[model samples]
Target: MKGETEGRFHTPDVSSITPGPRRATLRTADGVRIEAVHDPCAKGPADTAIVVAHGFTGAATKPAVRRAAGVFAQYAAVITFSFRGHGKSGGRSTVGDREVLDLAAAVEWARSLGYERVVTVGFSMGGSVVLRHAATHRGSGRGRTEAVAAVSAPARWYYRGTPAMRRVHWLVTRRTGRLVSRLGFATRIHTKDWDPVPLSPVEAVPLIAPTPLLIVHGDRDPYFPVDHPLMLAAAGPAQLWLEEGMGHAENAAGDALLGRIGDWLIAARPAA
Candidate 1:
């Protein structure tokens, strides 16, 4: 990263220099145009693959996201994309409901590139999306996800315990808040509520059984306390990790932690 100056380009580092990703526009099953980027593994065509799902108010080009992608790229091929209503994608966000389609689209793209084992790693809202996506498309679709991991995700919807979550509710529900989010956060989420509310992460995690699940959380997270990941852990046979001082999302994820995530993905792969 560069100085505190705005609009200054970051000096590239060898550790963070991911091979040029082939950018493409992927159409979701619901006909949304999702902007996706595929970064082939530095090690060439390996059977294993990793699909990265970003959190709310996240985009593919963000430094944290790009750093994670670069780290993961060292082990397996990586695919990162912007969900609908965020970044360069089309259509409005239904929060996590319709967002599952975005992840499915990315997973399908990975399979299209001939990756046999696709392991999905998601953060926050993206964590919820991946859990639902794996359950909804379980044992189906061309690139049916083989393994799943959720980090800093809520167990249920409409949680407003923390001030951060309460503010998040405001951003997703109020018109004025949406405008603020558009102008300030650069996130274009719909103001409308979920029509026929989709299943929550707790509900979806159970269905992810037999398909290895990893649930990672931070004890110091402000938006959600320990209960969220614990409730999710109780629902199924998931490998749980409770970090000491981490806060929220990818921004809190350090290089060492990211390396462990990459190791988890590599370990999650079923023997070919």
Candidate 2:
């Protein structure tokens, strides 16, 4: 939250056990310039690359974001990017709708860097983008995603809002939206678009089956109920990590969670 600016978010600098390679300015298909940090340790061409997308109001340099990147870097090249309007990246956030494009761009960027296999990890709204991208790839026969992992992702966008969320939404939309709009920030990014069909993780899971997925959520997460990951697991070859006391992005940084994710990725690697 401290890194959140008027438009973008910034993450803290992470210390790595081994210094990883660095790069900047990976351009996407839509012409938006995405700023990415690449960390490849002990590598010529990496065996795998893990690309991370942060949650709503999160940037590439957040503590959790850095931890996730570090976890993957232990075994593979890791590329972390801030979504449009959420970091040094260009363009506004289209919620998760057009953010799918951002994911695609990130994947392409990773592949271009000589990573033969690529896995995607996303948190919250970032998780939604991962599902959408996997679905889109499966539909187009582009190629299968090696693996996908999500943390605290909501199943639906406009679910029955909790009393707390309702109050928070009211307050933010009323007070914050007004201030953001007056200050020239596009507050409409938070507004939902009307679609007869839902675009959340629940609806997207059925399409991701056979493609390995790991869904981790806190049992006590107030924003997205624990049942969301349960529903997703029911639909795919997905494993659920329900931490008893963790909430929201709680697993985003933990060594235990990252170790589990690393093991999952190693086992789920695509066949050569």
Candidate 3:
């Protein structure tokens, strides 16, 4: 890992003494290569690290994504990666269904680095990936996550309500949309429909019980309504944070909010 010096610090600010981020390329179980970066923990008691999964069309190098790593470095180690079909990662995105493998790869990478505890934090579409990943891997007895946090995630799938969502739907549902995605977002996503139907966020939440979960949603989010977070909170053991005027992920995630998430990851680590 590279050495870390400057970044916004939270309560622990442990990352002030930590090393800079280390860059690596990882392969998923399905053999898709994912571009990843790791930030080691600062000199302190916390041995926990965070694995960050970015939202749709977002890469590990986005300004907001990079900023999150800097802010999170204050409290603990962090690993941020681009999902398949985004950035330099290989393979097309199956949206929420097959993205679980992307997260699984990152979690395994964190364990290989000797982190005693790993918490996964995802935003928007990434939020759903973390949820399904946790549920799908729970009790598998291998590389299980210690905690999970979902920000501004949708509870259900195939939502087409808002104008933003409608545009997004077009991107996922039409062939022309796929071309636009490749040109604009550098993401190549599946154009077909889900056959067997993947587990929605709410359906997966129950399976993740006992694993500490934090659900943070903005009340003013234009993508998903408040009911999404409310439904998720009711389905599982989760601490819900309803921001007064939060928008979407990344750009909408301020430094203070990012630091708070760092605090939660630190606090959620398994007790010694």
Candidate 4:
């Protein structure tokens, strides 16, 4: 639904609600040490845990990420982490290619925390990771998600349809850009390209059927147009929300939008 609009909702401030102690370092199957944090629900004890995956150059500690987590904590226990090469985590980012392993580690850790159900919410680069993670671990219990929400995710890889994406391409593909990313953004980029080009998000979405899926995108997103979310919605039974006046990713997400997402997570159920 190109140009479709939704009512705007203002985000609430929850900066005073600090996240709980940092979790122990998580070890990915690929051996990356992922840093994570857990925030108990503000409403009360909950059986579910929401794992948040941040976009490129974003870490669990970023203000935007923390703000989102604070909002989510009102629904369920929240888990937020940095992918490899972002924040204090080890190794370099393969962008979204190998980040699924990072997500898996986070999901598994959440499960270990005694939560009966674990769902994932990811933004931008993180959005692609959650989609691929759900598909990749569909058959496995360790990382299989109960529900998945991908916000502002690309349907396919190598998308340079917009100038923001073109700039992102430069950040990942060029050494000078990588340096800038490290110094300015504190995100490290891998020097190599995807060898086999892992499963794209559109290809992964269909595989996530039976697992409740929600694809949320802003009509005014600069990185990816509505086509991205539309392609994802068309690929599977995902519920799509083409929000009006919204920008992109966590930064653009309002507390009202995040509250709706948390409400969805609370209501969503996996297929029997």
Best by lDDT: 4
Count: clashes, candidate 2:
4
Error of 2 at 178 (Å): 7.0
Instruction: Order the candidates by TM-score, highest first.
Output: 4, 1, 3, 2
lDDT per residue as tens, model 3, 111-139: 66667788899999999999998888876
Give TM-scores for every candidate, taking all chains together and pairing residue i with residue i: 0.90, 0.79, 0.90, 0.92
Query: Clashing residue pairs, candidate 4?
Result: 11-255
Model 1 lowest lDDT segment of ten? 1-10
Q: Across residues 1-272, which tens digit of lDDT does each residue of candidate 4 receive?
A: 01111111111222323344445577787878778877888877789999999999999999999999999998998989999999999999999988999898888777766788899999999999999998888865978889999999999999998999999999999999999999999999999989999999999999998899999999999999999999999998889999999999999999999999999998898667
Clashing pairs in 2: 9-86, 11-61, 11-62, 12-61
Candidate 3 RMSD computed on C-alpha atoms after optimal superposition onto the true structure:
6.2
Candidate 1: the clashing residue pairs are none
The superposed Cα distance between candidate 2 and the true structure at residue 248, in angstroms, equals: 1.0
How accurate locally, in lDDT, is each candidate?
A: 0.83, 0.68, 0.83, 0.88
RMSD of each: 7.4, 6.9, 6.2, 9.1
Steric overlap count per candidate:
0, 4, 6, 1
Question: Which ten residues in a row are the worst by lDDT in model 2?
Answer: 1-10
Candidate 1, residues 72-162: lDDT per residue as tens digits?
Answer: 8988989899988888888877778899888988887777666878889999999998899888887766748888889899999999999
Per-residue C-alpha lDDT of model 2 across residues 1-272, encoded as one tens digit per residue: 01111122122343333255554565555677677777773344456888887877666776778877777777777878878766677776666777777777777666655567778888888888888788777632323467898888777775556674564355344656545642453223435444544367777887786677888888888777877888877876677888787777624347777767776875784334
Give candidate 1's whole-model lDDT: 0.83
